[model samples]
Target: MSKVAIVGVVGRTNAGKSTLVNRLVGEKVSIVSPVEQTTRNTVRGIVADPRGQLVLLDTPGLHKAVGTLGTLLNRMARRSAAGTDITCVVFDASQEPQLEDVGWMQRVAKEAPDRVVFVLNKCDAKPFFSSMFREAWKEASTTPQPSPVKPVWVDCCALTDDGAKGVMDALFDFAQEGEPLFPEDVVTDYPRKLAIADTVREKFLSKLHQELPHELGVRVKEIAEGNGRWAVAVDVLVNRPSQKPIVIGRSAQTIKGARKAAEKELSEVFGVKVSLELWVKVEPNWMKNPKILEEMGYMGAVI
Candidate 1:
């Protein structure tokens, strides 16, 4: 019988959770950015081997909820952890543990996730919080564990694939005997349109700093395939008219830069030449707009 593990990967914002998922699965199925909350949905990336398969759910990094979208993303992250075969909380141990890191530790302590794994991501960098991370584990695991299985710890660098295999091995060791949930060749089940939107947003974020990314949203307005290339149109949604110029930049340099980069990456991902058109529109207070949120795949989150 083939064994299977449904693993939920969670962490604080920019904790390298998405990078970890892509590394483990041996493919890019999640959007990664330095910007906080780049991942806003539960993306499942499958790992296949002769012995078993692992379904890794890469979720939004937990952070303080500021609006309906923020609340929904947090809930989605926490929700993805529940009832999984294993829960992996990734920590950026390179720096001191932030309140968000502690928040996850406290949550797992109280909620007691089953078959937990504590991942010290970014092992390539000096781990200043090494002791604190261990201490957090001791504190959380002190109370009744969510599962009889003692939590496993692995230190890995998500970007370089260093120690990433150890994480996969640890998960496979604890997997349950079951049939595969997806085909062996498939890497992810994320929607194509949303993936395009995320691709655009990621490139856009790469060009900016500060709170701009948090205030912007990307939507694939249209997509069409022809002889040898994909014609895609995207809208960059800003919260205020004042913010529009920032996205488009002086003489449209920023948007042009963002578009070219996005198209290049999108082509590589989709295995076909891609052409992207970008437009910036101001949607005041879009974070609170239910219709826009739903369009962005917030799952009808009513907060």
Candidate 2:
């Protein structure tokens, strides 16, 4: 018999949740960005250890919602934590705790205090405050939790993959012995279309910085496969006509750079040669469009 568990990786925005999941999976299942809420979907990154397997759900960081899309993402993140067998919260130790971090602790303290793990990420940077966080959690948990045991705490550097194994180890201890949920040799089960869109959006986000990371979206419209090569077409979505030129850039340089970089990275990630094309389309408030949100995998298809 083997052991298996579904571990929910949750944290506040820009908490390195995606990076740690990719490290644990040993592959790029989720995209990483310096911008907040880079992960807008619930991505399952499976980790196979000699002990068993852990299905890690890389969820969007919990944040204040400005629109319907933002609300959906926050709900997904909270629901992921509520449904999983274990909850692992990643905190950026490089900075002090924020309100969202306290919010998570409060919820988990009242809900599943014992079945939690605190990952003090960015331990590579100094001035560690893991002890302070632990004490805070104790105060938060003791009131509502019924004689809860302390949650496991691990120091990790998600950037360099340092001390991440310890997080997996702690999870394994909590994982019950059972049959494996996923086969070996599979890193993630995320949809291919969404993955491709994420790759393209990642490059776009890298290039544009603070300008449009929050408003724009990516959708892979078509994929043609033949002769061991893939032809992929993607749409860059913005809210208004005015934002179109920014995505296309001066003389199309930004779009071209984003396309070239996306194609190269996607080729490596998917383990196949890819020919990619991009188009910028204006979708006025597409985030509120249920059909568009469904197509983007932000929600299940409407019945």
- List where candidate 2 sits over 4 angstroms from the true fold: 143-149, 301-303
Please list all clashing residue pairs in model 1, or write none if there are none. none
Give the 10-residue window scoring lowest on summed lDDT in candidate 2.
141-150
Give candidate 1's error at residue 228 in angstroms: 3.3
lDDT of 2 by residue, 113-138 (tens): 45788899988887877777777777
| Global lDDT of model 2 | 0.87
Question: What TM-score against the true fold does each predicted structure earn?
Answer: 0.93, 0.94
Clashing pairs in 2: none
Superposition TM-score, candidate 1 onto the true structure = 0.93
Clashes of 1: 0
lDDT of 1 by residue, 18-104 (tens): 999999888889989888899988888998888799999999999989988899899998888887888898999998888888788
**Model 2: residue 111 alpha-carbon error in angstroms:** 0.9
Alpha-carbon local distance difference test for all models: 0.85, 0.87
